[model samples]
Target: MALSVVDLYRDILPKTNCGDCGFPTCLAFAGMVVSEKHPIDGCPHLAPEVVERCNQELAEQYAAGKWTKRDLAEDALTWAKERSASMNLSDLPGRIGGELLDTDSGKALKLPYFGGHVIISEGDITRADDRELTRWEKVFIYNHLSQGGSRMPIGKWKGFEEFPNTVSKIKTMAGHVEAPLVDRFHGRLAELVDAAKRIGGMEMTGKAHSADAAFFFRPFLRVPVMLLFWDEDPADGFGATAKLLFDETVIEHLDIESIVFLSERLRQLLCDAADEAPQKGNT
Candidate 1:
């Protein structure tokens, strides 16, 4: 069979997905190229041979030096349609009833609805009420606090109180939480999910999960403007996680700005973490 577009795109570059093209990953940039949404030149990773090969097919388009822009738009729309069709909220469980809010980063002590607490010391322990234990059932929360370069005493909470044994913490780089553009992007996400709910396409709750509070939404989109916190299982350590598991198509259609913001945030978050975490000198 002929080389698949994905394969072709991968072949011409390092495929390390370093985001040099200003896109989150290599494949995303390739999709834009194949769709003629962006020109091959947009990718800094492109080798001279690859550029020459692409030039032949895009000779006419390149005359105006608009190949990349044209292709980016085309690919973006196609990607968006595919994303919408592929989005599935079905697998996701139903929504919870309360609303709690906190900073995207998990550092803030907001969201009192869940009676959130922390263990500031290694031996520090906070007991949880068995009755309140059930409140953590079936939810998801993303904490942005750990995204900073700071190493917190979070692990201490690991064994404290009734904190679910299922809790998982995600550490990332810094600068994601401070980006101003994130406000509009997250606002849009909130609005979109709300709109989705109005049409019976959503399940939302505003509760914070202490154990897994920062578990959702990382590595994929880590912009400082927004942090996601959720509890997919209330009994499972607050269900907070950092995994970005949106549909492939939805992942494709994600607004570039949103993707950029999130990706940059994640990058910074990870960077910050490495800087702060104790490390041995090169052996």
Candidate 2:
């Protein structure tokens, strides 16, 4: 079988967004390569042996007409479906922190989310309110189905840097997720708190750090995230800062990329909520 462009790209590149490849992110560079706009050599960090192997794989895939990116999500969903199909529905509730319920179609697992309840059965996903699941939501479900474990959250929190294989992604995570929040809500604790609460976040008290505000978000059943923000103090010369933490088991539920995606999405959600909130001077 021909290898996927995503798989091949992952194998060839250094997975670092060094910007020497002329793209903001390595994933963007991979897209360009898959579309044939750039060659694999565009990435300067690849070792010689890896480059040769990737070129060989890319050649075979091109010859086989499997160089398209259109079916990447579908392929991932199919893979997750296959994994879920082999598991017993009854056991999923305990394993994935979901609640199993009987539906007209059959047994299904219901996991709560910020938007609504997500129903999963045999690797298929649907919303409890009869709405269609978004592409990101589907991806989250696929990841949960494949990576979720039977363990529960132990209440211990660690930052993204603490997660396994995530050191290289720390810069991206901070730039995309934490910086945006700090930029938007700096010194606006009330607005930040309101936004967090609107998005199903709970305020955490008595933290050891000097964080002005801390909120916990559960974007998925098994994925718990904690965000802390420290307001800027000009007199003290301390600029505003934000830090996001997750359970140690988070790595077992989603890859670093997916976790980053979730954080960015949460940032957007908070920004939207802040915009809709009533201002002090507004009517």
Candidate 3:
């Protein structure tokens, strides 16, 4: 079996939590190395032979297609399909607020969504209008199916820190999801709104929060997320800030890891849209 990053790191590193790698701990350094943010040789404690072996193992795993995202997605899909095979497709609509419809292919669960209607049946997902499902959509649907929760959304919103076991990940979540958004569209509220609309996000008004802008996006049938932004105030010396809020029931539909994945995907979509927009003085 191919070793996981943790496994590889544990096998090669001294496991001493040494700060010699310029990180607070060796584990932190290992994480950076796995993410390709740091070179393997950055750990001065590692001997030449250990570094050579670690590099060789990484290369072998890559050659064997063990660490590819596609491979992981396929594995997750397979596991989800197995779990879904025993589920009652008819009951999912009531549980998750979707509609059961008879299609030419067969009966499928349809959920009206931002981009299009998402149709799910027997572990497969497709657009209701016969369009292709994006990769992110497929993964999201699979995770939704695998989780198989019966609770309905209560319309109560909470930040990631409030989710189960997510208090420790709040910083990571903010860095990955909110920071990038603030960096890309800090003062450009109109452009951000336009990008959000292109991705099927709806502007929400009259919310309790004193945000400069707020929008709602439904990434899945029952998973509603809210994005709020606070522009910088030079007089007050407050920097631009962005935050993501999830319905309290979000944990029922998808795990925290998958939630992070969706957030990152959202950030990517907004950034890509921003990049494609016409620049000043450009045709």
TM-score of each: 0.21, 0.69, 0.67
Question: 206, model 3: CA deviation in Å?
Answer: 4.6
Query: Which runs of model 3 end up more than 4 angstroms from their true locations?
Result: 1-70, 129-136, 276-283
Tell me the spans in candidate 1 whose CA falls farther than 4 Å from its real position.
1-4, 58-283
lDDT of 1 by residue, 128-154 (tens): 232231111101111121112122122
lDDT of each: 0.35, 0.77, 0.76
Query: 34 in model 3: Cα distance from truth in Å?
Result: 18
Q: For model 2, how does the per-residue alpha-carbon lDDT over 2-120 read when each residue is reduced to its tens digit?
A: 44557655665677788998989888888877666368887888888877777787777765656554556666566656755667778777777778898888888888876468888
The better candidate by lDDT, 2 or 3, is 2
Q: Of the candidates shown, which would achieve the greatest TM-score relative to the real structure?
A: 2
Cα error, candidate 2, residue 108 (Å): 1.4
Quote the lDDT for 257 in model 2.
71
Off by over 4 Å in 2: 1-79, 82-85, 280-283
Relative to the true structure, candidate 3 reaches a TM of 0.67
Report lDDT (Cα) of residue 46, candidate 2. Answer: 80
Q: Give model 1's clash tally.
A: 53
Give a tens-digit lDDT track for model 3, residues 39-148.
67888988999788877776666666564444566666676567667777788777777788887877888876555688888748888788776665577666776687
